[model samples]
Target: MELIYMKKFLDACHQAKRITELMPKLPERMTPRHIHVIDALFQLEQKEDSVKVSDVSGFLGVTRPSITKLLNELESLGAVEKIPDEADRRVTLIRLTEKGKKYYNFYVEEYQGWLLKQLGEADTEEFMTTVNTIARVYKIVSDQKTAPVFPGEE
Candidate 1:
């Protein structure tokens, strides 16, 4: 049975994975996970005056302990700091340091430049249509799946 559509989907996935080669590499002492955390903080801070550890954990869909560990590493690198909330002395909030801001700005600029270069006069509306189609297909596929099986459950 030749699933021609599946072949195209798998090929697209391979190409998408390869697209990372065009991305700017992270600066020293920063991993992809760190970038994710910084991005979450960047977006969350836009809506909230102060972002808590739980905010990041919820944004990233990870455990609070895992977020705390990553925050500790980021803090050690001077990328983020934990400060007491002004209204509540016992509550702490997370904020990016100047270094983190630099990282975020640099990466966003670089990534945008790369994406624009790749677009190279492409039609914006058509590009968006294609992106939306892929997202809808993904949602349909995900909705068809049952609960995921864990390793030990099998």
Candidate 2:
């Protein structure tokens, strides 16, 4: 009985591993750092000014120097522009150009669209239930790692 559920869990893990394998490597001259920065800018959308280096650094838990280097690479690609912040001349803000925005959208949305396509045939609630069940079992195993054993279980 437990083996049946174990098989199901292993199957799901294998499928997720395949999904990771399917994701492409970054393009020439670009690293995951650049993508992380782009994603940070998208999320840090401030009305008054463009996103700043500090913002990306904070979001990614990386140092400003490293993020600045990645930003330099992105700037050379003409994907992003560094503008002087309106409120603070000392601070530089990062803003994605149209090309950068398109690139960011492509990277973020393509996988999401592919996933929706894969799940499209399933009924939504049933899909959610199955996903939730997998999540529940993962928690059970995670808890067991820290749980104290009963007297006979050593």
Each prediction's whole-model lDDT (CA)? 0.83, 0.78
Clashing pairs in 1: none
Best by lDDT: 1
**Candidate 2: worst-modelled 10 consecutive residues by lDDT:** 42-51
User: Which segments of model 1 are wrong by more than 4 Å?
Assistant: 125-153
lDDT of 1 by residue, 23-64 (tens): 578767777678778888989998998899999999987899
For all predicted structures, in order, the TM-scores are 0.69, 0.58
**Local accuracy of candidate 2 as per-residue lDDT tens digits, 1-154:** 7899889878988997676555567667876557667767777774434577887888776789988998999999878899987788999988888978877777767765777787778798887887898778778777777778999988
What CA RMSD would you report for each candidate?
Answer: 4.0, 6.5
Please report the candidate that would top TM-score against the real structure. 1
Alpha-carbon error at 53 in model 2, in Å?
A: 0.8
List the lowest-lDDT window of 10 residues for candidate 1.
16-25
